[model samples]
Target: MKKIAIFAKVHDPRCLGVAEELVTWLEARGLEPVVEAHLARHLKFEPGTEPERIPDSADLVVVLGGDGTLISVARLIGERQVPILGVNLGSLGFLTEITLDEMYPALERCIAGNFQVSERMMLKTEVTREGEVISSHQVLNDVVINKGALARIIDLETSVDDYHLTTFKADGLIISSPTGSTGYSLAAAGPIVHPALDCLVITPICPHTLTNRPVVVDAGARISIILRSMNEDVFLTLDGQVGMELKAGDRIMIRRAEHRTRLVISQSKDYFEVLRTKLKWGER
Candidate 1:
């Protein structure tokens, strides 16, 4: 019997209902259903089942909530090299793209060891002040260095592969992976890149000069940003979940992380189908 870790958002009825159903289904099939602590109270689950417990014992991690919840759990199990299946119960989800109807079949394929695993890239971001490394973080999405709401426009000096790129006077900057190209990068007028591509996109937020457009960089290259303004409130955000404050004379670096997130995709689905369904592309 394969041990499966079940995680969901308790606030959503759809997620809660699905979690309960999955627990019963897994148990009937002689599989152990391990749920996250918070979701335990919502379902009629047996005692002594938790996320931490299952990650060590389970064969797979099944996340039934939105992208944010999945991201949280993914980070919790980071570098464990565990495969995760995301079922979307929220809106505009890029990570949690699987539908409710696809749940059981996906699980069945996992149990049968028949599925495709997409190795999505992650980013490692580091912040330095006065040449001293202060903070570091890992993000599956883009790394944004921008100014606060009340702060004035900021100046950022960017470089790719140690080669100086154009400086930007804008609200902020976004450095995103190909998998994250459809996210904030797309909203910032950046091109949408297929997830299979190995590339990084750099987009400026509200550039003062219209000539400064977004640029796509090679994935193997290193990206560096220098905070040129001495009197502005700048900040660094990771996957829009974690953030750090930036000071003048501070330098920020971004590169491909050593670890990757293994996402299980349905054999019947394609990336273009996801784009069309989620984005309503070419629709009147």
Candidate 2:
């Protein structure tokens, strides 16, 4: 890749040093490295680009931090389909599967054109209020509809492909992609789906009716939810990052976006190994 973009969680102390070293390494190889304006200042680099503009010209993007940071960059990527190398700076991450020690090796493989990528599905979410589209977002993880701490249990009238599904009476609801099954959905007792699968999971958070369980649907299905509760402190969150308060009668539409996130697979480990390490699977 000629122009490689670097996105990082600048707040993490470890990221600064890693980024500095990475930049130096890229320059030594006669490759161009781009950093965010804010982070470039910390690294003493001249004339850095903005985050939103990084994907416009970057041939590949490298993300440094946890899964949250990777998710943010995924959103920024939108429909670019650029390959991303995610290096975890902290604990084990689902998306940031490559650890700090593996970063250089992964980069070497990438430079040698010997890397593989996993195409992860993304969700397109649209908020419609009073017959007007207010906002739209693309998320790599789950779209959460939740009530405030003091708010009462909200009612979400859900449907699939225009077919009416059950009305979920719960603290919240999570609609996640196969890649997001291990996120909020998992914490809400939803099933863990393999990322290679093309499906969506609908999970309820503390449903009043215990029978309300998580449901998996086809990726082509058009899922929609309408807020049936009034005067409730409810909100819709995208990837746990962007959010907006929901009003009564608002319609939230979700579908598999045409855009997909391309993540560079780590050569050191497989998916099951990652699950075993992250989940502590089989540990007594």
Candidate 3:
């Protein structure tokens, strides 16, 4: 609680300003502030810390950007179980819940351990060829398998555990955690799931078949997707941030990761409020 890690999007003027103010406020309160290397250059203070040195070395992380920046920090500190407090600077940030006005209050509660923690489920995805692992990645949002621009429809043969699900003739497939149900999955006609739900959502994007609908599965089940078409070029995207190209005959296995992301939350805020505000639900 005496030392904190601060991460922000240096590209955003709002984030950079708030980050400097936060460092000054923390230092005045006799608390140590650690900022990322790139962010430090834009900061009023001298550059000293790096992303690799934060979270593990500090008690908590204060994210001063939109949900995208927070998600990146979540992935980095997720393994250490360090709590992250996000300050929203982007439009429609479903993950960044705290506002600029609420920053000090949230930080006060966090340092005093007077806050709640939401454990969001993460996905552990592995791409393998001939049973040998080719690439491995973790995602906080959703794992998307889609075709490249100007490419033809890709064939994805999806299966749940031992049961053969179906062959999807579509643009792509999205496997999302309950926390991510409102993201790409929702745009693909997937249902919105509460973060407390311990389930996985399977949504097919632009499916050729009308009967192919979004399906929810137990988090414990593993999903295997085999690339069936050879001519078309497809790729795998993680959290919409990282992507990898896939060739025919590649197998992608997705399941709930053993490690979970711990997000710091204020007790007063509710999930439905966020839904209403972000989605403009029930608004005239």
Q: Rate the local accuracy (lDDT) of all candidates.
A: 0.85, 0.93, 0.89
State the lDDT of candidate 3 residue by residue for 203-254, as single tens digits: 9999988899999999999999999989888999998888899989999999
Report how far residue 237 has shifted in candidate 1, in Å: 1.1
How does candidate 3 score on lDDT?
0.89
Best by lDDT: 2
Please give, for residues 116-230, the per-residue lDDT of candidate 2 as tens digits.
9999999999999999999999999999999998999999999999999999999999999999999999999999999999999999999999899999999999999999999
Candidate 3: regions farther than 4 A off = none
The sequence of per-residue lDDT tens digits that candidate 1 reaches over residues 1-284 is: 38888888889998899898999999999998877777887775656466666667767888988888877776666677688899988887777777888989999999999888888888888999998999987777788988988998899999898899988899999999887788888999989898887888999999999998989888888999999988788989888888888899899999988888888886677888888988998899
> Which candidate do you rate higher for TM-score, 1 or 2?
2
lDDT of 1 at 15: 88
Model 3 residue 263 lDDT score = 83
Compared with the true structure, model 1 gives a TM-score of 0.93
Query: Looking at candidate 1, what is the lDDT of residue 71?
Result: 77
